[model samples]
Target: MTLLQDPANKNRYKVNLVPAANGLNVRTQIPFYSPWRVFFFADNAADLAETMLLYNLNEPCKIENTEWIKPVNYVGIWWEMHLGISTWAMTERHGATTENMKAYIDFAANHGIDAVLAEGWNKGWENWGEKDAFSFTEAYPDFKLKELAEYADEKGVMIIGHHETGGDIELYERQLDSAFALYQSLGIHHVKTGYAGPTPDGEHKHGQFMVNHYNLVMQKAAEYEISLDVHEPVMFSGLCRTYPNLMTGEGVRGMEWNAWSEGNMPSHTCIIPFTRGMAGPIDYTPGIFDIDLSAHKEDREKWNSEDRGNTAVHATLANQLALMVVLYSPMQMAADLIENYEGHEAFSFIENMPATWDESIYLDAEIGEYIVVARRSGTTWYVAAITNEEKRDIAFIANFLNEGKTYIARMLYDSPESHYENNPEDYQILETEAQQLDGFNLKLAPGGGAIIVFEPD
Candidate 1:
């Protein structure tokens, strides 16, 4: 789908669907039907965030007994590769070796995280981006898939499987059942699938061909009771309601962009909840303790030409922490090296944060400027607020807290000396007693944010 603005009329626009030309575009015999074109109306960002039009438009749950469909907080051998501290392809610094996987699994288990994702455990990174170069069911020489899976299970953690098809849908389609069966047999219920390159038939990711393919994969995954977290995927349109196993997707500009490029503007996250977030859950993979790639500079220069050394997370450390609450994803990733998180005081927030929420409230928002949201799991309430590049002051009202109950609010916010560009790591943690309807004012540094966890006192 392409949107073109009129040259003569500034206010006019045109929407066009590019032809697939692949004969499979549309081949209905009787009265053909098109997918629903949706338009949403909202009086405020809160309303926008709370809208369920997309889910309501889709069909009801098709998979009965969704007992296996569960939310997970995961750590992975993913971000290290992006930082150039390790390589995806097997090498001296290969990130997905059995030892690395076991270490990550141990970290997740110790931290109360639910799962560990091993991206390079499978054979294919050596030929990444090449069609048919990946064997989804085959393990790399250094990665003992079955052994690691068993170890994770022993440690009370699940392995989030990875399948990088390099955008060769044909190859992935052929191996879908076998690949899913392999994980299912090993008791791995969650899978993160990637399509990083061009499709075999020049198909657009959002085009009909890929849309059908995505749906097919989702349905097939259900056969093996494997949930999916798809990257380089088509925009989510509330399919999770019908297929609850369609856990989360990476259709928006996500964290990895920060590693190799100028990274997302501070406002990028501030605006997502009102836009991309309304569609469904997003796997934004938050929680980066290392704001700048200072520690990995030499390694990045040697391993990844894409890392020019000028790029960083482009937000304060507190902003990364706050995103765990701001962004909604059932399968959330604590996306940093285990070494970075080890013994870090702020890492406590990520460790205690819940991936599944019982309820949510969009407290306040201004599109692309700032947003404040609160979510509740059991009796605890987690609130997150983020801003654009400009520093601003905001107030948090505890009216959402349980009535007549006293609570303790632990706030992690950007320090007065903090700035996204200069001192991104400076942050302060404060704890205070709070009563229902109580309020407090916070100072958010430029490109910064805050997270407050309220527990009943």
Candidate 2:
């Protein structure tokens, strides 16, 4: 009459005795409760993070014959709808017309963004309640698709297609091949698929069937050499190891929530890297210069009430910029309207950061409180740190740098006059020389963040 128990309190491994219906006591066991965690006794925070990635990841899963697998730093037409600046339909406020798209293409090309995403380029966006409301191949009258495609090709920018099917998987599956063929012919190798609203497959979005459905879409996308970024997706659990082209996902409370609904708490990003982010990379769409939410007053009043009532993203402008590094999305989006980014020096950070990284180090982290990360793209290293609603001050030892090497640290962070609730936009820039033996200190405002880049001199 013995029951198996955990041998030690600190170890995560556990087991229990199981009795069969026939009263047989078997030596069956349970796995570790903390399956995703691996503790390491390393030299520093950077060492711990690098080791963690190595512990969990398999080989890079690039598909065969997929030539020119490009990185996905993108600019897109998503934030306008949330901000009430534009609608997807063919109306006065519509933002995805040919003229407007061409302007965005120019902006992206000038800023080093690799792809452009237009949400309502196709017809049937206004009729979601009806069956087959998404037509991926047919364009609206004002959205000159072929011309825009040619322009993007000439500019050396890829055009990312959008397909929001209102959860009508049947119709989406039926149109899948033709839609993919259209994109392939036009030289587009990526698509952002959305499954908003309920699933018609009589299953919850996370149900086995829906997960299988999402997998089927990725498998098919690979056939056409098209990578996928799915919204309203199943939680990522090493799916990238199986499908290398499965880039970013929108499964958690994202930046747009601040526009229309009660925005995500400041702790959201700090928490996700261990929760939702542990499953896969997230397309959180982080760039927004207008924290006040007063830009579209009439729309805010008419739709969500002028009270605004804690609808802000609850972070400083620097925090938004820092998210590009802390949130590890290969398919990253500078998701704000192009005009909002004008003349902003912080925009330069977004422009300079690359979509892929050769190595990453989770420098310091506390779940739902704060996090610090460092990553190397090429010869340069970028560091980003973010805090929760509470104010925090952090200290970093530059021992992560190579020994005896001198580097310049370029920082963008909240100023002394800034607070996420009181003065969200105030930021200061600093440039200084540092070495691996030196130390750095950071002061974070309530719901604030910081970005530091180290380049060898």
Candidate 3:
């Protein structure tokens, strides 16, 4: 769906449907009606962030039993491949071996993380970008799916099943039921579906064909009481509120881009809460302790030909930490390697952070510049703020705190020397006491961010 500006009228804009091989072909009965062209209005960015108009517009929950649908805070073996330390294909340096997944599962069980996602556990990753190259129900020899699932269950952690279709919709559709049934038999409740390559029939990723395909998969997943985190998916249209099992999706340029290309700018995340965030929850995959690729530099050069040796995350360490609160995803990922997080002081924040929230408040925002948000879970409140490339001082009153109640605020923010390019890892943690109406001031470095967790004192 392309937004085109009017050539004749300077102030007018229109939505255009780009034609693909399938074109805009839809045959319906005589009484058919087109979908709604929604337009939302708000007095300010904060008002826009809090609006539930989209959820209201969507249908009510269709499933009778909603208790099975729950939020997932997961760790994964995904980042290593993106960082060039490992390969997705079944090579000597493959990332998704049984031993590696078991280690991740053990880490999740110990760290309060809910599940573990193993992306390359299945076969056909070697033939990525080719049609009909992947089998949803098959696994590589190195990855023993049944054994890993049993180990994860014993550790009290769940395995997030992966089904990368290589954009072969027909192949996925044929094996969809059998694949879901396999996962169900293994007691796996969540799956992350990927469509990394072009559709075989040349349908646009956002075209009607893919849209209907996604809907069909979601409906089938619901039948088996499974949740999904979809990547390369259609823009969310508030169907999550209805299906609920459509937990979160990746419709934005996520953290993986930092590993491969010139990373997302500081302003990119600042703009998301008001734009892409309005659609629904996002799988932005936050919490990277290693701001620069220092640990993997040598290994990356040895293993990955695609590594240009220049790509690194363009945000302060605090900026990555703050994203857990600023960006919402029910299936949130601590998207760094386990070794990067082990024995790290900053890891405490992610270890204790909650993926599901009871309430969220937009404190302040200026689109593409900066944003501040506060979310509450049970009695604790977590506030996160992020800035663009320019350093600035942000001050706000904590009137949202419970009246007359003393609380402890644990703040993690960029240090005075912190810069995204020069010293992205420089940050400081502070603890202070606060109450209702207390004024707080924060100095954010260029391409930096801050996170504050408030607990009852």
Candidate 4:
């Protein structure tokens, strides 16, 4: 096993002290024993805020700290729109065979992705109207769980499995052994469990059934050495510190809402950083680099066929790449289709993101309008600065980089010379070196953004 340690061998990645008006933003960091290199953050010396200590891989990667801090750190992507369809469904769209799953896997592997989360691959959603959600084992008969696991393993990719129990806590508890057996037998490590809708007869489960269920799963998962990615049930309360495998959970209407409902307005993405995201870690998989706003397909209707106008493609790409630092999901999702990334230069920005961070800093921001965030995974650093519907020509201070430490900055932002409007895939990528207090004036179009990565000189 490759154990991580700082130059002093303290196993600590960073320790910083930033003075604020109310108090100091004191952050100390350390490494976790897992695929993603994670470093938790806190306000009061690691006591008030929780810290995630990873032992084995049972739960998804987690945002160990997000307490007054609106923007946290994460970099990941999702495979399905919701718990609605399997990769096979995409093949079915073209009358292709399920074997195409390999192609999807290859696409993800070729990209610099941390993990691939396949939703709706379970067996409960079909009978959701009957309160019988989904099941992973029975839904995709062609899904040889073992082979899928091996295939992902061979490709150096991790699988984030989904298990939608449909709030049948009693049944899930009863069949715990069988469920555990299936995952264990298949060498699966991470699971995205779901619980939507009201409890039976108003009896209810736990006051924090969502949180409690996650805790319960963590206990069981620890026994089997697995990780968890929960959805729709609990609010994040920093259990991730106690249960490192608990990567992230969902509690808001994500990109899927855009496909199906008019309520999920284009502005909704900018709204989350302050509202639902404030509670803690949200699996609000952001990075939909493609805002076709005009593409049509059979699944489009299934998603409710809402109008998503051209919101500046570059803005979307900027947000997706910036999400690595702006949003917080250790096991975060890229949340876009494979074809959407094809031939897009900014896709390289996505492929280069590190899911876990050794250090992070919430540079600056105004809730709902815009935010700037910076995160570091070792010698490497990433920064994302984004704005809402308005266009911006803002200046950025390279204060986060080490002084005297020469570094290369790869940046993608809007330019006046380009004919494309908010076209993220078409934006010019530039490399520059920073050795002192340097600055860059980024001009973003309406619904546009800027994404930059820095590596040690």
* lDDT by residue (tens digit), candidate 2, 315-422: 898899999899888899988888887677888998888998998888788878888998898879998989999889988887778888899999999898888898
Model 3, global lDDT: 0.89
lDDT of 4 by residue, 1-457 (tens): 1123588767565532223323433223576342344344544321212233323323544434323111122222233343123332323432112244455667777875645555555454446646444454654554455676688679866666666676777667766656766877766667777776555443333333333455777677656556676777555555565556666778787655544444343345556655556545667667776554333343432332343432223345555566556766766767666776778777788777777777866665655666666778888888777677777676778887888899988888755542224354445679998754888777765555677888987
* Candidate 2 off by > 4 Å: 1-62, 298-310
Listed per model in order, the count of residue pairs whose N, CA or C atoms clash below 3 Å is 0, 1, 0, 27
- Of the candidates shown, which would achieve the greatest lDDT relative to the real structure? 3
TM-scores for candidates 1 onward, in order: 0.96, 0.87, 0.97, 0.74
Task: Name model 4 segments beyond 4 Å from true.
Answer: 1-98, 131-133, 203-211, 263-271, 293-299, 303-315, 417-426
Per-candidate Cα lDDT values, in order, are: 0.88, 0.80, 0.89, 0.58
What tens digits encode model 1's per-residue C-alpha lDDT throughout 1-457?
A: 5456899998777765644647454545777777676767888877788778999899999998899998999999998887777888888988899888888888988999899998888787888776678898999899999999889989999889998888888889999989999999999899999988887675777777888899999999999999999998888888999999999998889999898877999999988887788889999998998898775667663455665668899899999988888999999999988888999999999989998999998888899998888899999999898889999898977898878899999999999999999999999999999988898787999999999999999
TM-score of 3: 0.97
Better of 1 and 4 by TM-score: 1
**For residues 1-457, what per-residue lDDT tens digits would candidate 3 score against the true structure?**
5567999997788987655565565545788877656777888887788888887888899999988888989999899988878888999899999889989998999898999999888888888777678888889998999999899999999899998888888999999999999999999989999988777566787667778899999999999989999998888889998999999999899999888877899999988877788889999998887888887678873344545668888899999999988999999999999999998999999999997999999898888888889999999999999999999788888888999899999999999999988999999999999998999998999999999999999
Between the candidate structures 2 and 3, which one is better when assessed by TM-score? Answer: 3
Poorest 10 consecutive residues of model 2 by lDDT? 16-25
